[model samples]
Target chain A: MAPALREFCYWMDRYRRVWRGTVVISVANPLLFLAAMGAGLGKLVDANHSGHLTGTPYLDFLAPGLLAAAAMQTGVIEATFPVFQSARSGGNYPAAAATPMRPVDILGGHLLFVAFRVLLSGLLFLAVVVAFGVVGPARALLAAGPVLLTGMAFAAPLMGWAVGVDRQSRLNGLYRFVVMPLYMFSGTFFPISQLPHWLRSVATCTPLYQGVALTRGAGLGGSHPGATAVHVGYLLALTAAGVWAARRSYTRRLNR
Target chain B: MGDESAGAGVLIEAVGLRKVHTPRGGGEATEAVAGIDFRVHRGEAFGFLGPNGAGKSTTMRMVAAVSPVSGGTLRVLGMDPKTHGPAIRARLGSVPQDDTLDTELTVRENLLVYGRYFGLPRAEIRERATQLLDFARLVDKADEQVEALSGGMRRRLTIARSLVNRPDILLLDEPTTGLDPQARHLLWERLFRLKQEGVTLLLTTHYMDEAEQLCDRLVVMDHGRIVAQGTPRGLIAGHCTREVLELRFDDQEAAAGKIRHLGDRQEKLPDRLLVYADDGEDALKAVHRTGVEPLTALVRRSGLEDVFLTLTGRTLVD
Candidate 1:
């Protein structure tokens, strides 16, 4: 256990060296998105809709959804290629296998790193949200809870998918076919209520849809505690399932 | 001795160990390690002498506790690898066939992280990493990423990483497979020092000279089975005559028919013929007496390669 912790610290420190540029680029993306969609299109929406109850300032309405989208993007990007590279081409897992650390430690450490990165990125995005005046400081801090949950929900299954893929082609297909669609349809940029009924039902079942709902609800000062609990529960369940599947794949691939 | 087996000092023991790998193409299963048994005592260098795909690496992986045993009883330091993998792995250092160093990290960080994996303290890891950098002669490159180093340097760094925990048993799989003569000699010298320090070293290689130089005892494997086993000298003495006279012939027919009666034991290769005898010089003189004009003639002492050919009925090289 001590050794695993040390190894985790080493991995985190190594990540710090390599991810400096990635952190900068990641922080810049949300700010760019906020500027383009929130401020640019937001002004037009504010000018058009004067007294509609469903209409808040466009930037305020878009802020929580953008945070959820950033979390998803961060989670999927970190969870896929890098995990696959470490498992296959990079030989990091094999190196760890030669040590006293078990497969569980390796998987747990990677998930922990992903969780930490998501938290850090989510915090940065929240700061952006606060600067945009979309939410107060109190609500912004509270937003981290749902943002992290959303990130973990996406990361868990993606990590499982990454572990199961031995070749890069399969992972690329997964990203193109499955992840891209989920990102477009999971109500990150618009309310699911605007989609068709069947599509809305489909979105409601997805983990990301639940993530966006919970986060946007919390960020906008709307209270739907029961619904938020259900989303949180689903995310936790997905995390467990993804972890189990990833662990199975890791043991199967590594133990010859 | 209180018990006859008590003083044997067996550090590694395997009984009927077998490993069957399922082929990717849905064909018949390939047995990488067919049931074989051996034991290594403390402070002895053991070698597995075999050609490629002969189960040497598979056996080493099982001994290293990285690969599970399919069927057999195997123990390292009196602990079952299946149940006590972490404990056994903690006490063993392994240099795999391929260098698996973390390329993203510096040479010093590689050692420090590996030491930390063994639960070493931060202060101890720092001190050990420094010493290992010196030992691998990579002190100048300690801050450089491993990918920037040459192959020999990376190999040395891996060797250094293996010693981070100061393991009792060290397993090296083909340590000098692709090294040039100078690099090979440097590695041999380093390993020789480790032997002097009383670390039990186990290795496998295709280089017969490496076996003779580093191994106190060796087993020859072919087609996933142990074909021969003994000390290098003992195996050479038992299986082959003392010397060999190698003869090259430009004309194949004339050499084959003419040199049939030169020695009691002989082998015919594609371009040359080997005459095995107690006295190579005498055998060469006798061949000359036969008036067979050979293109080249040389006398050399027999080694493990001779034992391998004699047991397997084929040369070590394909």
Candidate 2:
């Protein structure tokens, strides 16, 4: 086995005993949000502003939006505290670095595990969305690709930043000032076109907006190929950049 | 020595090895390892004995192939550390000062997962985990979380985890620094057994007795420099007398002036006076004849403590 894969087994072994507690975030939280917002609150919006929703039901539009948003939340949440813990003194990064594993191998293994987590959660969310009749099975399955990519785009760079953090309080600020704003305003719950002009452009620049657009287009079936290419390209480039940053941060923090 | 084993040669060789750490923001770069030279033979226990912040851990980090060297050259297992760090590390096991065991995993899982880092086969790692649990005396706590273990147990597990690959050389930095006496002795015994089994051991410690108990050879370090290097007995013999006579007087300064001519050399500590002489009993008698009535007196064999005091003119722990 390669060293990175070997380091990956360490996290997998740890997750085996603690994965039960995470079902709430991965399965339950999204399910509850879908039921309350998509079915309950969505009822009022569909009954009145059906024309504004482009003739699609609010439940249909909100399901894929929630899927993309949930991926962002899970990806950032998973990448932040765990990365900080591993990079801290008396943590596993130093221990792993003591063996044949290099700092790059350590970062690679951790990101690989994060990708697995995002993919697993995305699949679960898609299955539930399909059951609700929000989108067809084929469309829901296609949406999974964009959902996973969206998660990685957020998770990868945050992993790098978390390694250099001096304390846990910085992570809380990131959630409040960065992640929460992106979640609330990135065209997840409503269309960005409703926003004032300048704010719409700002929302479009955020990674979560691209994610929301991709999943919504894949689920509803009317996206232009050129626009779809743009969304995918943007997410791919961000994820690659995040990986590069994480490699540099891990070497500086762990190897020292 | 057997021919095959003898041909293996020195396990580690360093010439003027150095490490300089530049502060993160903007500060002067301090040299942690100031151009030191040392060698470790294949099957002996070698040690670095020094006080805290004496560059012992820094030197150990460089030899373990984790910290980059600032100057000079270092070779481990006949490979240059700068170019072949991963390769050198593959054959070595490191037990750091802190216990970095995975707290979420069980004691047995810690060993098993660490073994996987070396890409060992699953069956082999399983077998190794069982034996290592037994070796660490953690068989009963194998299924328990690491957080539930005591400091000593956690330390033993750390040591056992480092051995999963059956490494050729084992590096321990301050292994018993925070343990209780019984725990320290237990760890020492385990380390002694490993040394007897011919797993070359390199360790750093502040306790003079630990060095005397385990090290076949040692170097006394202070301020990033080696002051003396030799076997415990040889170091004591070279730097101190055969015995030390300690006297506690109400006024040490006054008593020191009175009994100045009694011994070969005298060191006055805050509470007592240490007289170095071949015969401590005779030295004590000489002090009494000089009309200085000490409240208490002791005669004992000289050891590494005196050697360090004689070489550096200071105590080791302070």
Candidate 3:
């Protein structure tokens, strides 16, 4: 096996001992959104808008968007706090570096584990939304790919930002100022078209908005072919850039 | 005896090795390990004796293949550390200044997890962990969390964890620092046993007694350079007198002048004056004959502290 892959497997074994708390949030986040938005808020949106939401039921429209948003939340959380902890007081990466593992192996293994987490949570969200009868199996399965891509689009960048953090409080400050605002205004709860002219452009430019649009367009109303490619391309570009930045940051921090 | 081991082939050899660390914010680079040459032969205990900031730890990190070498050459287990770090590190065990033990895991779990990092098999890790716990004298605490262990126990566990791979060479950087006297002795005994078992032991320390007890040969460092190198006895024999007579009076400065003729040489400390003598008792008797009536006086054999002070004209701890 490749050394990086072997290191990744070591972390998987390590995660089993701490998986209880994260497993709870991964299963519960989508279910809560399904109940509150798809059932409760869906009724009001359906009643008030006779033909709004492109004639699609609000419940079906919200399911995949919430799934994508939930994935983004899970992925970003994994990238931020855990990355800092491993580098800072946790000292896990340094310990591994002292062994036969290289700096590249440590960085690759951590990102690989985070990717697995994003995919697992995305799958869980898809299952619950499908079980709730919000969307059929075909769209639910297709939505899985876009949902995971959206999560990576957010997670990979957060990882880059997390590695450059010198102070512990910097991460918390980022969550409050940047992450929270993006989560709220990224068209997760409503369409960006409802926002003002300038804000609509700002919302569309953020990664989470593209994530919400992609999953919603794929799962509820089938997307225009050209639009889907643009979202996919934008996310792939962000992931590529984020990986590059993370590699640079980790090398500077650990190889010193 | 040490010369015989040197001809048996070297495990670690460094030629003009160096390390430079640039301060954050683009400040001037501080050279931690200025160029120095040394070698550790197979199955010999070598030591680097120095005060804090004397570049001992920096040198150890380079040999461990963790920190990058900035200049010159370093080979551990016959492989260049700059290029073959993973392969070099795989065959060596390192106990850093700080424990860095996995605090959340039990003592046994810490050993097992570290072994797994080296890609050791589960059955092998399990068996090695059991023996290491006993070797570290933590058999009773094997299942207890590392956080609950005392400072000495934690240090021992860290040393034990490093040994889980049964490494051919062990590098310890001030292994007994901050440990109590009894704890220090216990660790020394364990390290001594490793040496007896023919493991190549390389350690660093500020304590003169630790160097005298554990090292077969050592180098005294000052200002990022090796000022003197030899066995402990050889260093003392070369740089210091055989014995020392210590005299303390109400006024140390005045007494220093008075005691000039009493011994072959003298050094003035804050509260005491050290008179280097071939026979310390004869020097003490001579001090009484001079009618100085010193407040306190004693005689002791010379050690590495004397050797360091003789070479650098400064105290080791200060």
* Native contacts conserved, per model: 0.74, 0.81, 0.50
Candidate 3: what lDDT?
A: 0.84
lDDT of 3 by residue, B196-315 (tens): 998899999999999999999999998788999999999999988999988889977776677688787888888788999999999999898877888998899999999998888788
Off by over 4 Å in 3: A50-52, A55-59, B1-8, B260-262, B286-295
* Residue pair clashes in candidate 3: none
For residues A60-156, could you state the per-residue lDDT of candidate 3 as single tens digits? 8777777777878878888998788777633677677778988777778888888898888888788888889977777778887888788888888
lDDT of 3 at A237: 97
Best by lDDT: 2
lDDT digits (tens) for residues B1-318 of candidate 1: 111242478889889999999865598998999999999999999999999999999999899887899988987888888988888889899898888888888899888888888888889999989998888899999999998998788889999999999998999999987888888998999999999999999999999999999999999999889998999999999999999899898886787798798776888888788889999999999988888888999999998988888788778868
Q: What is the C-alpha lDDT of each candidate?
A: 0.85, 0.89, 0.84
Pairs that collide in candidate 1 are: none
Provide the TM-score for each candidate, comma-separated.
0.93, 0.94, 0.91
CAPRI-style docking class of model 1 based on DockQ: medium
